[model samples]
Target: MTLQLDAYMHEKKAWIDSQLPLFLQETSIPGKLKESMLYSLMAGGKRIRPILLFAALNTLGESEDKGLSTAIALEMVHTYSLIHDDLPAMDNDDLRRGKPTNHKMFGEATAILAGDGLLTFAFQIIASDPALDGDIKSRLVALLASAAGPEGMVGGQEDDLEAEEKVLTLEQLMSVHRRKTGRLVGFPLEAAAVIARATEQQTHSLTGYADHLGLAFQIGDDILDIIGNEEELGKPVGSDLNNHKNTYVSLLELEGAKKKMADHVDRAVVFLRKSGFENSLLAQIAAFILNRTF
Candidate 1:
């Protein structure tokens, strides 16, 4: 079945697949490390983040080709985060997306460097995007940096680490998820609207949608951790409880967690609808986030 997305996620994935190798062409960097980065990146994901970026931009109804660089940049940033997340120092997982994780295939040091390389490369792509005005690109870079940097994903991760083996309040748990998950997820929405010159009102509305989507995605992941089959998930299940990482869904009853997730899903849909988005595919993607079994 074709997955619905902004303009179509399958199309975005296809475009990204074609663009990634071309962008990965080596210059000064050694081919080996570059290959390692591409190894995990190309291994395939839902590409949800980048597709969200596309939808966010498309909502402006501008048909410019300028959004492509930002789209790819977001994916690179996402890929780098995953590489680091799966390291021995972090999640320490042996498998990812039905394949050996970067550390397992390329060794931990190389995997770390590869992630670094991708992070730097993502900035390069953003700064060099010709389709967007330089000022807008700069703002996009800043917004993205905030999400990916210490105050965003990195900071959230720190919170996650500290909370482990310690009891946490509901607010603390949510704070961790917001920074860890919300910042990265927010990039597409912010970047898209910023590039498209959306009004402040529109940008703020999209932010709400992004926040809801981010929370919902993490909640779905928590549910999957308990109920997903190993073969199906391509990773171990119940790892959150196993790792003792506190998650909102973990602290709540199953029914309560499901209700919270439903609330988030409904809010996301409501925000998107109110924003006057005409994209049926974007609407469907929101539904998919709520409906996905995997």
Candidate 2:
């Protein structure tokens, strides 16, 4: 199953990488801005969000290609977030994807603009996608906006920053992660249902799977921060500790954190099974998130 997943990820990542450049090439943005945007966008990572979008579409007996526009926009939004997250004002990271962060390479101002460009262009991509129905495109655009907006990922980030100065209880930490990470992660799955016009029951089931999966993914991230290798992580490990952040590991310890992560994955898998959509691929993807070391 691991080997199969590796193959699947390799193929999907290659497709994402290949198409991303085409989107950049078509953009009319001026020289250095375009370069800066491309630099971070091309920075290598797991490409998990876009893959989730594809996987969700696939689980609905729909072609993954049907989700390509949404997938591309989703990756753009994710990359934009990463670029902003690494800024001097945010997490203040020095490296990402094994290279200097966007700010380091392109100057802080340019990096900020690059992130803005990606965020705006993502909406444009969704709005302009000719393949999807107009109603579908409109709904997707709204969903993506809400997921990336101040009330969601950005708001979670604010909470995370606030938490750095204080001790966050377990529940507070969970709320922070659900907003900061879970909502964006779940958006792909929800968008899949929207595109597929899935039944209300099916949508509800996938939403449950997505909710659990998102939380599990963040728990896995918190666990990895304590035990991960810097080389594999592409950024320094232990940043969470250095920042005095309260993570699942801090709250529950390593063994307890792992168990909690496992519990979420179990719940996610149960929901996936209940979704009844030939979800072998989606189940593997969920496992991949929990088991991922990097």
Candidate 3:
């Protein structure tokens, strides 16, 4: 069956959106904290990480149900990162997805706590899933920790902050984003591979595809920051310039960055073809990154 990328993305995104709120309905969570967490978690975006997990599962010939808990967990972590990223101490942005950022709406302390809660709860969700065996749960937990922890997203964020106002070589910039943005983006595919019990070779191919896809995604983001409409992005464009942050656009110029993004997308497609997922929805997603508006 030919994959309709738009329909596939919509269906998977809807599934993730419905599942997200249900995970936070526990009575043990304090009402205000729950509200704050849900505020950012439900904030609208493409839900790309969770959708990628489902797409990877499908490409690996596994049922999406097998990765349901992991998908939700991934989104929680992603949202948590966004909450922290928007804190006054961090990006200091007031808008996300067309609404006030969590800190702006809930206060900085609550927003910090909300981010903390989501980050911790994400691991708990994977650890406590009834359908996964102990071994799979352990693997999932470890991978999530590595991806969201200091070695991955957190590390990249720190590097990005430190690099502010300092001109970075292209290699240096890529290194920072590989951790800050790329790790989380790559995690979905790796987590799905774990759920599907894929062979070593299959996992390798997916990981390769993920690495290039992650770079392509970041490059596209850099381009969008310069050219995207604020209404469409739900936030101000050129904030990178305002903050003096080095980006692909800053380092490579607009046209150079676009060409570099295209290069990564082409390489990503090669890995997908090697993995025999060239016709899968994952391939379509790689293509979409080339022209994404927000």
Candidate 4:
């Protein structure tokens, strides 16, 4: 399953690489700025969000060519988030994916510019794609903006910073993670529905599925923070503790967090079943999320 997922991910990775530059290269930025932005944007991660978007589109019977714009755009937003999160004002990390972080290599100012460029370019990538109808493109643009904006991913990040030294209840912790991380995951599922012209019912089911996947992914990340090593994770472990940000596993205790993740995975499977996602690869993807150490 890992082999299959890895192979599939490679295909999407190639697609993203070829198209991502088109978005950033046209921004009229200096050559070096574009280089730093491209460097971090091209750096390897799971590519999970873009892959999930493509997988959802595939099951909806959309062609990859038609989905390419969204696939790349979502990846840009994700990469932008990581570049900013690794900044000194945020995670203050020096390493990511076993390389110097964006700020470390580019200086804080350039790194900030690169991230801003990526974020703005993500919308442009989606807006300019000829694959989607004007109405659908508009909808997706609004969807992404809201999901990544103050009400969603950014809001969650702020909450995390404020929760420092505060003992978050399980619900509070869930709130922080669901937004900071979960909405970004959910956006792809919703995007697939929009692109495929799915019915309201199907969209609803897919959304629930995405929500479960998103939250479960966060729980697994929490567990990794406790058990994972920095070399394996490509970042420092226990930084969450050092930063005093609450996580699902942190609040629940590791045993309880494991149990909660089990529940989440099960619920996600149920939603996928209802949505008729019979793809074995997605099933294996579920297991990967549950089992990943970094």
Q: Write the per-residue lDDT of candidate 2 for residues 26-117, one digit (tens) a residue.
A: 76799999999999989899888888888777778788888898899999999999999999888899999899999999999999999999
Instruction: Itemize residue pairs with steric clashes in candidate 3.
Output: none
| Tens digit per residue, CA lDDT, model 1, 70-150 | 888888989999899999888888888879999999999999999999999999988988788889988988998999999
lDDT of 3 by residue, 1-294 (tens): 234988888898988889899998864899889999999988899988898999999999999998999999999999999999988788899999999999999999999999999999999999999988899999999999998899999999999999997999999999999999999999999998999999887898899989999999999988999999899998999888998999999888999999999999999889888777888888888988888898
Worst 10-residue lDDT window, candidate 1: 1-10
Off by over 4 Å in 2: 277-279
Best by lDDT: 3
TM-score of each: 0.94, 0.97, 0.98, 0.94
Order of all candidates by TM-score, from best down to worst? Answer: 3, 2, 4, 1
Worst lDDT run of 10 residues, candidate 2, spans 272-281
lDDT, candidate 2, residue 220? 90
Worst 10 residues of 3 by lDDT: 1-10
Assess the local accuracy of residue 121 in candidate 1 as a C-alpha lDDT between 0 and 100: 91
| Candidate 2 steric clashes | 0
Candidate 4 lDDT by residue in tens digits, 1-294: 488877887887677777777766657878988999899987777778888888787777777577778878888888889999989899898888888999889899999998898899889888999878999999999999989999999999999889988888888888888899999999988998999998887788789888888899999988898899778888878888888778877778999998899888788878877767745455667777888876
lDDT sort, best first: 3, 2, 4, 1
Please give the lDDT score at residue 49 for candidate 2. Answer: 87
| Cα TM-score of candidate 4 | 0.94
TM-score result, candidate 1: 0.94
